[model samples]
Target chain A: MGNRSKDLLQVEHSHPSSSRESSLLVGKNDSKPLQQKSYLQGNPITVPFPKSEVLGKVKDFIGVISEANRNLRLYAKDKPEEYDIEVLTGNESEYIKMDLMLGIADLHTPESLAAAEAAIAGCQSVINRNSTSSSLEFEGSSEEEEDEEEDDGGEDDDTRQSGSHVRHKDSELQQDDFLSALLRSHQKKKPSKIIELSVQSGSDCSIRSMAMATLRREGKRLSPLISPRPIEALRSALVPYQEEAHGLRYISTQAVRNRMKSVKSIQKITKAMKMVAASKLRQVQSKAENSRGIWQPFTALLGDIPSVDVKKTVLVTISSDKGLCGGINSTSVKISRAIHKLNSGPDKEAKYVILGEKAKVQLVRDSKKHIELSITELQKNPLNYTQVSVLADDILKNVQFDALRIVFNKFNSVVSFVPTMATILSPEIVEREAEAGGKLGALDSYEIEGGETKSEILQNLAEFQFSCVLFNAVLENACSEQGARMSAMDSSSRNAGEMLDRLTLTYNRTRQASITTELIEIISGASALEG
Target chain B: MSSSAAVPFWRAAGMTYITYSNICASLVRNCLKEPYKSEAIAREKVHYSISKWSDGKSEKPTIRSDVAED
Candidate 1:
């Protein structure tokens, strides 16, 4: 194997392109001519002849020589430009000299072959020695020390087996000594001091042997048999243990501690928010209560009039702009959608004038077809009469409706709110009702100036009533938003507190387990030393 | 408790009442068939402001040429 690989390496170094060509020419019948052509170019040999073939053919001496001589003479005479006789003779002489130097004649003899084999073996041994020393130098000294220790332990085991032979002989000798001592003691039974001294020495030797055995056992226990390499062991000792389940690794103690800290801070923030919302709710609730009284007379005036003939209805959905108010905005949106659904028909078309972005975002998704106008940022500050009036003006100018239904979350309690709807008659509706003279009987009771027409009074009353109802709805929705936010923040703070407790318990348990493991290791080490 | 503070309180209340009466009067005037109803509504439309477009151009021209262009 070595010789073949070496020959291939030499071929590769000498004729890399020829080696590729030869590999391509392999197993083809035309390979012989290709090989000869490549050999004629610069290579000295095309194919190496086997020793057996060369030796076997050598016996056909004169016939083969005369045939080769005649062919060479003919070739030289016919093509003197291709072959030179003097150069051929010089190459022949060099070849004969090389063959003689290599002992080609004595190659068939056993003694010369043995000598050649011994020379080759010596060279191979030298190469092997050099390769092993180079490899050992590449591997560092720490590995060498480990190997040496392993060798020493193996040798010790072997010596222990051999030492058993010597131990057997020593035991026989000790037995003989014991028999002699017994006989001597029996002969001199009054020598108690010497016997006591011998017994004490025996006990001391037994105790020392027991201590040595325990020390060896502890050493073996400390250095486990399939131990990791030193660097790997150090890394494993430093890294914290991680438990993986269902492809999810458990968070480390420090990560859990950080989460707990963030949750604690969040809990504090939510608690403060809850307090602020509670204080703001009181002021908003009172304003909402007063606004209801302010709009009561107008509502009473409109309530007496029956609704006009069915036409387009405008839905005014009121919700706060801000979120984290527990589902107050969603409840208003849902109630508006329910109203829109209930009032939908072939003759009656529902249009929406959404207030606040929360309801707009939701309504625009599914009810964009019904939405006529969306007003936002009105809830940034407390709702005021002027803002609502501007909004009502915008609605009145842009949209036409028979009835305007205001959908809003009504403030019920600090922890609860309900979505409510209130309807205001449009100017046309009030005109139609006044013309009917059915519900306008109540209006006739009020004395008016001779210049003031009843229709003008009703129109102004309708517009004013529209703005008043919208203003009341806005205030009520604002109060409800604060109350809902207070309750939401209260619950969020409670949940955060619970999560913090859980995380703290987990952190404490992990720390306690680590401490206990360290204590166990120390105690075991102390007991091992004592043993 | 003091007459000066009471004066300001009455002034604020009177101001509120005046604003309210003005809004009601304007609403009543804007109603159809009242004085200057069409012109008042046209003026309201011209002055109406939209959040999206602020050029203050009315949707339609109020004035037109009586003579036909050649």
Candidate 2:
């Protein structure tokens, strides 16, 4: 209490001389500057906060101020270093992708083709350079001379030809005669040719299932054409090229498979797009037709109302709850806003009954203090007459309005959509205008006398118009909703197809690289084998 | 099951004698422990006498009277 009184007395003393201003002194240990110091020295007490906590708060505030800047810097500083590494790696990968594609093309084109041509030339040159030595062995003149001598000796010996018919007992005598003749021929012939003659006669004669004849016929027909040397060389040269061709074929098959997948995906997308467009077009047309049927009777009845001054108007704006159908809801909202703006006067007033969420959101901002009475989850099912009439009765009973208008997307055709406003409460002025323009052809045709009375007829007309307008609103909304859905699905399918196409292109490029490498190795190997 | 009827006489006798002798030896070995050398030998003799007749031989051995009675 003493301290409080002392502090109050100091404040009172300092209040008289306001120029001095350092009055609330509690303790010298206080780090905070006095509030009176703010008045005296004009230096505010600035609290120094922890840098890390302050920076965190600043970052939070910056995120609210500009999300794009904060996100970009945060991603750069805090994200994995692999992102930059990936960027560099992606460049390298792209180079590899290009090289791979080019390699495949080169394998089919100048590089591999040149290599194949060179290999073929080398093979042909080898054959040409070897032709001299090869021809010497091929002509085999000395061998032929020996062969001729053998043939002459074989022709003179009837024993050699007739031994095939030798019976079991006489075969021994025939064999003795054959050996004596062979000896006589060997003595008569040239010494070098004698051996060949014996070999030829023995080979020409069948063994008659005797092992002795086979033994005598051995080592005949030994020439260069039948030699294993050339065959061995040809086989060794052929192996590498054949292996290369097989590798190329495998790579080409994979490339073709990848391309086929992309082609199939494109075909699927195109087919799906056509289906969606066709279905949406049909649905939109049908809904338009049904709505048209509803609107015709409504318009006719609207021509019967007697009111002219639209001092107070009730606008019922209908739009699709879902957006994606080009500009249907936007135009409906725009037309509703225009009507509201035109009716805002001292005497004139405009009220709104929103049918869809999209239109309600738009109109809610403009209408000050006049909130919309929105019925939630009412548009999913078909519109019932009882519900529609209840709405109509509520509007008619609670609100005193001169004009009632409906703003909705009117489907003129499959391609043509328009925002249309039709008056339901005041039809006489519209009818007068139609008459003035020489269009009084349909009013007298609908008039029935004395069965109910003119006033009763007018009341019935009002009820019918209300039903028609409500039905039209629901049908148009359904059509617009379906149209939006179809287009959205179509674009989604197209995007997926495009992604598949790009992946296939990448796959082809990689496959091409592998094929090119195989081709190079094959050419080098074949050349090595040939040399 | 009756393949023994087709087997040679010597082979069948040998197989039957080996099987019976193995079974009798294992049963006596499991019952007797080390350090009872004389008693173990007597037990083995008794087991062999009991099982000897089970062998399918041309001249079959008879079981000892004491074992048969037991």
Candidate 3:
């Protein structure tokens, strides 16, 4: 509290306009109706949520004045830190009541996002406005935050979870990032021009949304702005947020007789999805096609190990999560079963890590015992390295094996999709193979330009290579799946066209026979009447 | 400079890999020869209807179901 008060005085003295501007920005960004209404004197506070959130500016101005008063009083006191701790205790109690008032589970997400967004823009401007003092203040806050986090975290197990404390640290780090970025961005501006600070939170790509859906959940507290950030890097960090693939199980063949008009409409939707879907397949396919591309060397280095001394083997079968994709899943399942038969015996153990729902439904009936891990809804999104890498990590964690054999449909042109297997040796096996000197083949030098022990480098290389191989295998399988579906749908649509013609012919024939019968009856009746 | 780091940061957190690769794939997809791309897309120019799998079970002529058949 004392530090905040001190900082406020320093900022107000340095730049008079900033104190007003800080409150204005906060008010504008407050999507949450945090009025901080006067319920202070040990009384239960009612929910003061006015229906109109337009009162943000009014409430925020009042909040700033109160903040300024509190800070000023604390600055006057000898021990500001002790007074601030009391303020924290008071706020924490009120926040507990506020949590109860906000009934919705995800209410905090948006509120936090807004707070973080404002913090980013606000902190950046503060650093830009007064450079030297802000940096010092930043270090102080960071040190305090770290200390607070250490106090929060004593349990070793809970650290595995990127807990609430870590997120607080992340937000502080984010402020540091903004400070650095603004230092660079501000340098380009005219010296005399005042830097305008407007918070842009609505942009989904902005740090607001990204903060909530961070890769921290994966136990990797990576800085968002360490280097050039490709937005897709964090794509997997976001929950798949897609319709579950299992829902497709309920949808059967077209129930309505698809008229010419209906067929055209269906084609339009398919076309829109396909334009994107096909190109993705084509890109992955192109990479696979290339004989001497830059990625080719990487692919080859990490590519198929023809034979590994199979003691305990894991067959990771790649198949589509959704049904109606024809034989994309079936062929892979067939090969998976065959490998299981080949590798499984008295001494050797082979486990199945099925990667789709379609195969799981089939394999569960027969080889339920060998199945270690089954992941579905994977094909709901396109394949990416980070997602696949995470998946590889998960698979490795669950199953300890000598050889990791990946069975996926290798795309060979439009019609031919071969159910192929790519084997990646475990790190220990790789080290063993290196000692025996089988197929090191100048590949080791290319992949890991070594300074460390050869074995240590190989261990890291093996894990990384598994991710790459798995990533490629998934892409190849996806391309094959798309091609297989296109051909299957093409033939089925043709069959439907022919069936429509046949049905129409039958209808016409029945109509003609009925008309002929009616005409005969009419003629007989007329002849009888004349006689 | 040789990247001494064992795994790319994207491999861990902050989406270094998924975004980078998805972007790369999209870029490659865009670079395809124009004629072949347009031709195939045009071939799929027309194809709609609701209530799938309803036909295999429905014996009645679809002429009277919902929308007035033309």
Candidate 4:
């Protein structure tokens, strides 16, 4: 390729007529050329010529030529030989004029258009969004150029094509710098037309592309001398497709990064909740250690029974105040609903004494009429004998019933809990049972002490037993809540981790793909410029 | 009708056994250690903020220990 360029330069130096012949030979001579980088390492490699600086230099040169032509046009009409010189110089002027048009066309051609758009891409997101369409136009134009003045294929192309087209008219230097009017009249007509079109289409993109396409098509048609060498055409066609793939890659990298960030934050939250729940479970389980036997007195006096035939029954539900414990509140609510259904009838009446906001909200929706006394926030503070005693006294004063059942969740392990109910009988019911000689009637066999009346002693014991049973129930329910919450948060954190893994994989693959596309663009571009 | 031990002071003062047991439970709950003690004391400490709506807007609530004393 280097030798061929040297051969073309020699032809340009010899005579204007043989330059066409040499360009044809270079086009046809692509047989079995030596393919080595060593062949191209020499002085024949000229500076890449289609740069904006080079274009400016060429324009400055044209300005001088046009000035000289204007002066010579006054004297050339009288002499025939000088007229021929004028015509031939006119032809050289056309070559330079074509150079000026390609310079302008170089700025407007699809590749340069894409570069300009890319320069503004940071500010104009609207423009970047339409990159695919603009890329289609780039390939359609097949204007082989890399990033402005930096990469070589198009600059090298402009240099080689302009070198062949602008052969010095008379190599003998006789008609060379003559103030002859070479194509001065013809160049004026076309550029004036182009300048008019450029002005009209400056601000609007659609009009600008239309004008540029027209200029390129007409410049090739009108001045057949300004033609691109045929070999450059085959290589220029593939540049835009390579760029198209890169454009697609650049679009979605940001979206993938955003998804990765959100998933990571969610994982952080769930992990913190899991840790909090574990610590809470430990504390509550320790407090619940001595709460088991407080219900023994009520059991001994009442015996194991569900109070199936009681006329008036009160079901006391112990649930946690706060939520996010999985299935703890719901399981208790379901059991309470079943017991409520069993205890409802025309002659029999049942009431709910709900403890805790979670179960109260559920029960309110189902049986708002049956709820007698609902107390909440019992678990917000630590449970103790005094609080339970006060609360049990309040319940006893607020509602009148024959049988009272305290329902709560009993914690067995970290992963298991049982819905349990401890039943307590009213004093009147206890006294009747003693008269009827049931298992609880054995209480009469012992000597009771320290009360003005026997019935008052029974009431004292009942109230004390109620407070103890309530304290135990509240502690057990708290332990269960903490255990359920620990497991729930643990699973949430695990699911977040899984989602993050999938997103990170996608993020890595996309980043790698974008990098490879850029490398392919640079290497393919370098080879195309070589061609 | 029964052999019995001597009555406690609250019962001798004509208070019911229910009131006596509650007083004992309260005293025991107040003697707990650290975190449990603080919460239990706070639970038993009741303060009423009494407010009166005269003509239009209600007056600022005033802390009243008299209600719990009664």
Index of the highest-TM-score prediction: 4
DockQ of model 3 vs. true complex = 0.01
- Candidates ranked, most accurate by lDDT first: 4, 1, 3, 2
In order, candidate lDDTs are 0.55, 0.46, 0.50, 0.58
Model 4, B40: alpha-carbon shift in Å? 8.0
Candidate 2 chain A weakest ten by summed lDDT: A96-105
Per-candidate TM-scores read: 0.51, 0.36, 0.43, 0.53
Per-residue lDDT of model 3, residues A192-259, tens digit only: 32223222322212332122112111111122222222222222222243224434323322333345
Candidate 1 clashing pairs? none
Write model 1 residue lDDT over A236-339, tens digit each, in one string: 43333321231233334878878998999999999999998889888888889999887789866767332344578888999877888899999999989988
DockQ score of each predicted structure, in the order shown = 0.03, 0.00, 0.01, 0.13
Q: Global lDDT for candidate 1?
A: 0.55
lDDT for each residue of candidate 4 in A412-442, tens digit (9 for 90 to 100): 9988999988777777888887888767778
Q: Pick the candidate with the highest DockQ.
A: 4
Per-chain TM-score of chain B, candidate 4? Answer: 0.47
Badly placed stretches (over 4 Å) of model 3 are A1-295, A441-450, B1-70
- Give a tens-digit lDDT track for model 2, residues A1-531: 133224323533533322111111111102112211222243234333233232233225333433433344468578756434325644454211111111111111122223333344344322322223321211222355446534544453354335323222222222333333333333332233223223233322222212212211221112222223433444456668867876765555455566667667775865576576567557555655765676675555345332335677877778766555566778888988887777668988777766666776665565623433443334433443333444454445445556777777766554456677767764344444446543334554565654454444454456457656766665665565555545555666677677767767777687778778778989999999999
Docking class of 3: incorrect
Q: List the residue pairs that clash in candidate 2.
A: none
What local lDDT score does residue A526 receive in model 2, on the 0 to 100 scale?
100
Comparison by TM-score, 1 against 4, better one: 4
